[model samples]
Target chain A: MPTFRVELFEGRTVEQKRQFVEAITKATCESLKVEPGSVDIILVDVKKEDWATGGRLWSDAG
Target chain B: MPTFRVELFEGRTVEQKRQFVEAITKATCESLKVEPGSVDIILVDVKKEDWATGGRLWSDAG
Candidate 1:
């Protein structure tokens, strides 16, 4: 199984996160032909000051 | 900074997830008193069949 870590700008809803998880899960499952239960999804949240994008902090950059 | 892997039942939206990331990031920064740029957040999504919760598949259980 392949593990993916997504980094992006903050400001989303629980529903939105759920969709992302579901979409990726389905995509991975089908592509890998592995059982859904065999997959694992983890969510890590980062703050603007703690995140960096384009050589700048997420908070400062975005 | 500590890396957290959150495993939960899927069915969230992108917006919802954004909020989660923000909240956790802020909390972690304050708790650790680390720069926001130092933190890294990743999101992983798993399908129902690939996820298991409470001894059952996430898709089948939920």
Candidate 2:
């Protein structure tokens, strides 16, 4: 099973998630040759304070 | 670099997360022979409604 962990900035509607998963499933199937049912995707919503780049948190930046 | 996606049932405290990541990082290093910094782990808190097993959602399970 191919598992995908997607990190987003949060505040996405359910409809957006539905479409996102559908597209992601298709892409994963095409590349990994895995069945739709076998692909597992977990979307993680990360706050700006929780994420950092180059030793600086996203919330700290403009 | 080994990227790990960990799914949990949520409600874990910050100390728990810190310890979890440390242990996971150590285990990964020992097994994969990679540096601690090379192992990237993204912890995903999965809601019962969002998770399913054997075609049944966890939230629906009695």
Candidate 3:
């Protein structure tokens, strides 16, 4: 089972997500030789406030 | 330190999440003998349309 947990900024469209998963699935299948059906991808949309970098929240970074 | 990424169908209440994380942290502490504060849990809510199984999206499964 090739399970993927991807965290990115919020605001992506459904079309973007669809294309992303398709590409990810393709890459995983080719690299790991796993069936496309067995790959599981969970996308997490994180608000800027919830994510921090360099000890500062992304929302407050600007 | 134990980190967990849990993915499940969306629609869970905040109270449910609070309780679930508490329970999971407790279990992890006891099983792995790690400190409660050291446990990190990220919950991902998945829509039926975004998840697929057996080469079919969950939304299309029905």
Candidate 4:
């Protein structure tokens, strides 16, 4: 079973999340040949202050 | 190129997360020989209702 953990910015609606999980489950089933129920996707929301790139926090960057 | 996605219960403090990332980064560097900056770890906090195992939701089981 291949579980997907997606990290992105917050402020998404429930409808968006429902569509996203459905699409991802379908794609995963098609490619991996696994059942939709077995595919687990966890979405993580990262704030600008919590994320960093190139040794600089995103909040600090312009 | 090794990114870690950890799914667990929420309610952890910033100090805990800071320590967690540091430890994970250190371990990854030692084992995979990847730099701290190269490793990214995304933590996913899963609600009991969202997680299911053995055809039963965690929230429903309890």
Candidate 5:
């Protein structure tokens, strides 16, 4: 089982997520020769304030 | 640096998250000999409708 944990900025619509999962599943199946049902993708919507880079938060970088 | 992505059913409180991060950081530092500040934990709250097992969504499990 290939479980993907994806972290990205929040605000994507449910339709976007649906398309994302479908595409990812397809890509994984092609690249790894795995079944689509074995690919599990968990999307994490991260707030800018909750993520930091080089000791600075994205919200503060603006 | 160690990054952890955890997925669980939604509905945890902020206080619970605070405690969880603290405990996880401590455990990582102790187990992996890593610095507390270098440990990153991302928690994903999953809805039942979005997750499936055995070709059946969790929302329809019952």
Candidate 6:
């Protein structure tokens, strides 16, 4: 089993987070052939200045 | 700012989870001294049969 950890800017609604979790769960279950309940996903919402990709914070890059 | 992600087998209560989060937040704040608001932590809970550590599933290892 595999777990996905996602961190992004904190602007999405709870509904969006719910849908995203559902989608990631579905894809992981299908791709990994694990039971849906076996997959775990964690979403961390952060401010634009807090999260980084490629060593550049979101706010800095944007 | 940095994000801390922890994945553990499911069993902790809400209060325990809250305390663990707070502990991590405090430690990060003290060590990194980033604004408390700038740090985020994501906790992922998985079934015993689903999670693996050191290349062994929890159920397999335990």
**CA lDDT for candidate 4:** 0.74
TM-score order of candidates, top first = 3, 5, 2, 4, 6, 1
| Model 2 lDDT tens row, A9-60 | 8777555666677787788778878777887666677799999999999999
- Pick the TM-score winner: 3
Span of 10 residues, lowest total lDDT, candidate 1 chain B: B49-58
* Clashing residue pair totals per candidate (backbone < 3 A): 29, 0, 0, 0, 0, 0
What stretches of model 5 exceed 4 Å from their correct place? B1-6, B11-44, B48-62
Per residue, candidate 5 scores C-alpha lDDT tens digits across A1-62 of 98876788988766666667777777778999988778776667789999999999999996
Worst 10 residues of 6 chain A by lDDT: A24-33
Q: Please, what is the TM-score per model?
A: 0.45, 0.54, 0.63, 0.54, 0.58, 0.49
Better of 2 and 3 by TM-score: 3
Q: Write the per-residue lDDT of candidate 4 for residues B17-61, one digit (tens) a residue.
A: 666767777777798787778876666667988889998988899
Which candidate's DockQ is highest? 3
Comparing 3 with 5 on lDDT, the higher-scoring candidate is: 3
Candidate 1 vs candidate 5: the TM-score winner is: 5
* Residues B4-52 of candidate 3: C-alpha lDDT, one tens digit per residue: 9888999999999999999999999999998999999999789865675
| Global fold similarity of model 3 (TM-score) | 0.63
Docking class of 6: incorrect
DockQ of every predicted complex: 0.07, 0.12, 0.30, 0.13, 0.15, 0.06
How many pairs of residues collide in model 3?
0
Q: What is candidate 5's lDDT per residue for B1-62, written digit by digit as tens?
A: 99998888888999999999999999999999988889999997897645544333455556
Error of 6 at A39 (Å): 21
**lDDT tens digits by residue: candidate 4, A1-62:** 88888888777999999999999999999988998889999987786545544333345557
Candidate 1 ranges beyond 4 A from true positions: A1-5, B1-62
Q: What fraction of the native alpha-carbon contacts across the interface, defined at 8 angstroms, is recovered by model 2?
A: 0.02
Candidate 4: list runs displaced more than 4 Å: A1-6, A11-44, A48-62
Highest lDDT against the true fold, candidate: 3
Q: Which tens-of-lDDT digit does each residue in A13-60 have in candidate 3?
A: 776777777788888889889898898877778899999989999999
Per-prediction RMSD in angstroms?
A: 11.7, 6.4, 4.4, 6.9, 6.3, 14.1
